[model samples]
Target chain A: MAGAPNQASLVERLVFRGTRIAALVILVVLVAPMIVIVPLSLTSGTLLIYPLPGLSGRWYEEFFTERLWVQATWNSVLIAVPTTVLATTLGTFAALGLNRLRSRLVPAVAVFLITPLIVPVIIYAVSAFYFYSRLGIVGTYPGLIFGHTALAIPFVVVTVNATLKNFDANLLRAALVLGATPRQAFARVTLPLILPGVLSGGLFAFITSFDELILTLFVASPEQRTLPRQLWSGVQETINPTIAAAAVVLMLVSVLVMLLAEWLRRQGRRIQGKQ
Target chain B: MERADRRRELVGWLLVAPSLLFMAFFFAVPIGAFLLRSVDNTDLVGAMPRTMAEIGGWNGQDLPDESLFMALGEDFTALPDITAAASLGRRLNHNLTGYRSLVMRTFTGLRRHEGPLGREALIAIDKRWSDPAHWRVIQQERSWLTPLYLLASLDLERGPEGIRTIPPERRLFVDLLVRTAWISIAVTLLCLVLGFPLAYVMASSGPRLSSWMLVLVLLPFWTSLLVRTTAWIVLLQRNGLVNQVLERLGLIDAPLTLIYNRLGVYIAMTHVLLPFLVLPLYSVMKGVGGDLTRAAAGLGAPPSTVFRRVYLPQVMPGIIAGCSLVFVLALGYYITPALVGGPRDQMIAHFIAYFTSTSVNWGMAASLAGILLLMVVVLYAALARLVGLDRLKAR
Candidate 1:
């Protein structure tokens, strides 16, 4: 009996060790690509062939000095900022209206709002080209901006609506009973509660517009080329290390913004749990 | 008293009006025009109404009468400017390949024609038109509205008489649509398989562990898609870290083919879309209580059985929602596959972009768009019937 119990303990120990090793292996497997690129991006050679010769920052320098890259980055920001603002504003109001409605209509309204998300972006882009051409808005800032906003609004609606789920209706009732108008109560009570979700949604909107390629392909002319558009053309036209450097910069910016959004979401979750 | 309530309802509509109107004008109107363009017949007959009318009585099966030919020559010569001829040439080009250059070259020749309307003028312009086949095409397509372009877009075309399937070699977009659906379904399944466990851990673990895990999941969301795809290329290439490690361990004799393949496409796409699955699943799982599983276990059930009967049923709605969301997203993926996947692995979005930009075939592009839209609507309806999206939301 003593021998049997000891053997069972030994087997349990081996199993535990194996499970830990498996988890570590999976983590390494997931992270290996990010690890490899850090070294590859620092290679001294002109070409990106493997067994990179040495180390240098010339590609990064070239990225900064290039006029087209600079202009494209500026254009991406110009398109993304206005799109983020419009999507957030419209999405917030839309969420408010949606929340006020009865539960029966909420799902239908959500499906309607999410149509842009569910549809293939390529189809929307093709249609937009014809639509904008007829309206004489094609290849213009307004056209691209509106298109981007439409793409981003669903993100805002989903996030803001999620945040509103935890909101207590009694507060609105309390505010109304205390002589606060509906607008004032919402501004002071509801807006503060949902601001984090709004911010995260806006961040998502910004990312969507900044990285958008298909719609920009249809709506943007050469003069209005955004960073993704420029990157796309560069990839199609030639193989260059400049794109690697641009990728690095874009990755860094997006990671930072995403981290901020994650932090906000965590904060919102904690607040809701408390309420 | 009732006016106040009416005023509030009016304000509610006013608040939502701008977005609704914007969608109608920009989104709805464009889709309508694209649908119209599928059957729009602005070419051939529209370009030469008088000529079409004069030749209307001539049966196209036989060679057109000399009188009809003379009428065409006279109409071609009477054009006050070269622009009309160019427009007619442009209209004909859509029906036949290599016709645009032919039209342009003929327009230049007609500009130099000095003779009266006769066989000499027609023969001088281009000998290609001496064949009756060209005249037959011209007479057949002399209608203001055509089902030809629309039919051709579906890999079916209307010739001199009736509609027929385009040749197998040219039957491209339909296959692409099927391929796109398969890829999207595969990605969605991959997301579900990988994300379910992670989301389960996040929802079931202690707050501290879940928070840390959540941060790791969200980290990839912040990174740019271009960077993520480029990172995969770097890692999966012949002598990259993955191969280096594999070689060191003697896992294989040589670096395996990985990047620029379907496997690479799946890897990069699954990585990018995994977070989409995790988020929705996490939200739904957070609302599920652990007690249901515990109670089932307490009632003489094993751990796996408890998970299956209790937890799995509860989480099915989230699974459906997350899968549909990820599937819809993966179907439209363009840049990732273009960069990572081989030529044959390219999806429908790539072709749509090709037709819109490089090929400049708006009719074909719109028809493809229509097909894609139909596919999404069908998938959404199926999903709605299966899970009913309302139940998928966080309670």
Candidate 2:
């Protein structure tokens, strides 16, 4: 570690070390449960109780083979994919529009766009359940997709808008000044520059839709059940090792997504640095 | 505005049109309609039109005349069957207790009747209806809207006389709201206590170590909520690792009941929300110059005094933002409490979920949700005022 030229007294050094140790401990507390889950999922016994009897892949196998688990994963994918596409496109456009407008309504419009992030999702679930039930779409994919899209849009808007903050409008002007039409300039110049943000925002939307459980509980029927809903019922209904396996898989997917997002973010930084 | 500026505004509006429409349809309209369910009284007025018309003119002192009784009998007999009677009875029972069974039994008696109905015969069929209180309740339900649900949420009930609080034994929603508030407050304080040192360390560290620490913090944020919750269940259950470690070390003779209780809720929620606190605080602390504290220290001030005078005020916005974020999130938390909490530990969100999903009571659900929404709005407003909502959006 590098130190400042100004020397610190014994007390300052002690306080620094103490705070560092405390921070490490807190970090462990935050990360320990996730680390423990992987090994626990490998326990050969049916029960999730700690102190493994032996190690086996039986639960993972069951997760892959069981009709309910398999179908729930498929349902989650089906919902999350459309949610990603829809939320990303709408959020990107809204960010673009906000970037262009310097009106007094900008703050108000931004707040409105982001209210889903602040509102208790239970309210949305109740409201969506009522509306979808009336429309006779309660137990269907489109219903869950629409509800999830509403929840996911704010995340996309926040991310894409953050990226737009650093965006150079003059690049588009340059493209337009060089005989490019507005649409062509946007497609060639703006989209490529902001694609990393757009993709990262889509990843966020995907995760939000994928992990959402409360809304799914309200709006989804048995056939429309997603993975989180399945996990909820599994915990409520039984204490089996299968849930540990599913949880491990869920964490794995989340980690992978995080890595992808981080890479995209670093790439965004690298692109910005190059420019 | 200039022509070019007007064109720009038009383009902006065109771009944002779809999202606005989407919010209006799926968000504003539906939520507005659902909140209206709390005051909706169309079910009763539509089902018992003649009874509503006749009962409107009657005073609360005594039972209505024979004509009103005939109308009541006509409405009850005209109801399709037990289901319709039970439905209307349930609506009326929101205002008056025991009307559900009263309506059901009267409907049964009316089903078997083969002769002309009158006030005397109706009273003979079910004597409870002879009381003016039940008649008053029916009359109160004649309106197209009522305060029954909003009042019920506060553990108050509407009567023929007016609104009054329910018995202490039945008082629940207020307690749930209070409990939810305290639990959220507790979790927010705990996260701040545990997170401040970590965030400080991260903010003060070199770039490489800070980025690595950032990854550690972001790991849980990116992980699935259910996954983290399930991990808590495994670690805190009766025969879980924590218990086994303590027992093996001779710390206790028996395992403590940690999971499925208030303690479990605090631990899990604090863990889940700690990152929220650290991230915002770290970002703010990073923006603050360290020289302020050093300057204070160099000016013959002690370290504690320097921190108290210089450091604390600068991070105040971060504190407010992080607390509001964690506190507001904790208020509506459902999954953690439902999975790990006991019956008494359930928050208002659990009840909202129960009424919305299990019991299918939109009125009760919307009322509870309305109260929860009010809390969120207040906290969000405070957050915006204290930390600036624009800063929150950047995060």
Compute the TM-score of each model's chain A versus the native chain A and list the values.
0.87, 0.94
Once superposed on the true structure, which residue ranges of model 2 sit more than 4 Å away at CA?
A1-9, B159-161, B388-395
Candidate 1 local lDDT, B175-243, one digit each (tens): 777888888889898888778767776776789977777767666766767677777776777765678
Name the best candidate (by TM-score): 2
Please give, for residues A125-173, the per-residue lDDT of candidate 2 as tens digits.
8898998899888999999998899898888889999998988778878
Best by lDDT: 2
Model 1 C-alpha RMSD to native:
4.4
Q: What is the lDDT of residue B137 in candidate 1?
A: 66
lDDT of each: 0.77, 0.89
lDDT of 2 by residue, B1-395 (tens): 59999999989988887887887788778888998998888888989988988887898677788899999899988998788898887877777779888898889999888788878878888899789888877777788987888888999987545788899998999999999999999999999999999999999999999999999999999998888988998899988888999999999999999999999999999999899999999999999998889888777676767778899988888888888899999999999999999999999999988887777777899899999999899978876665565566558
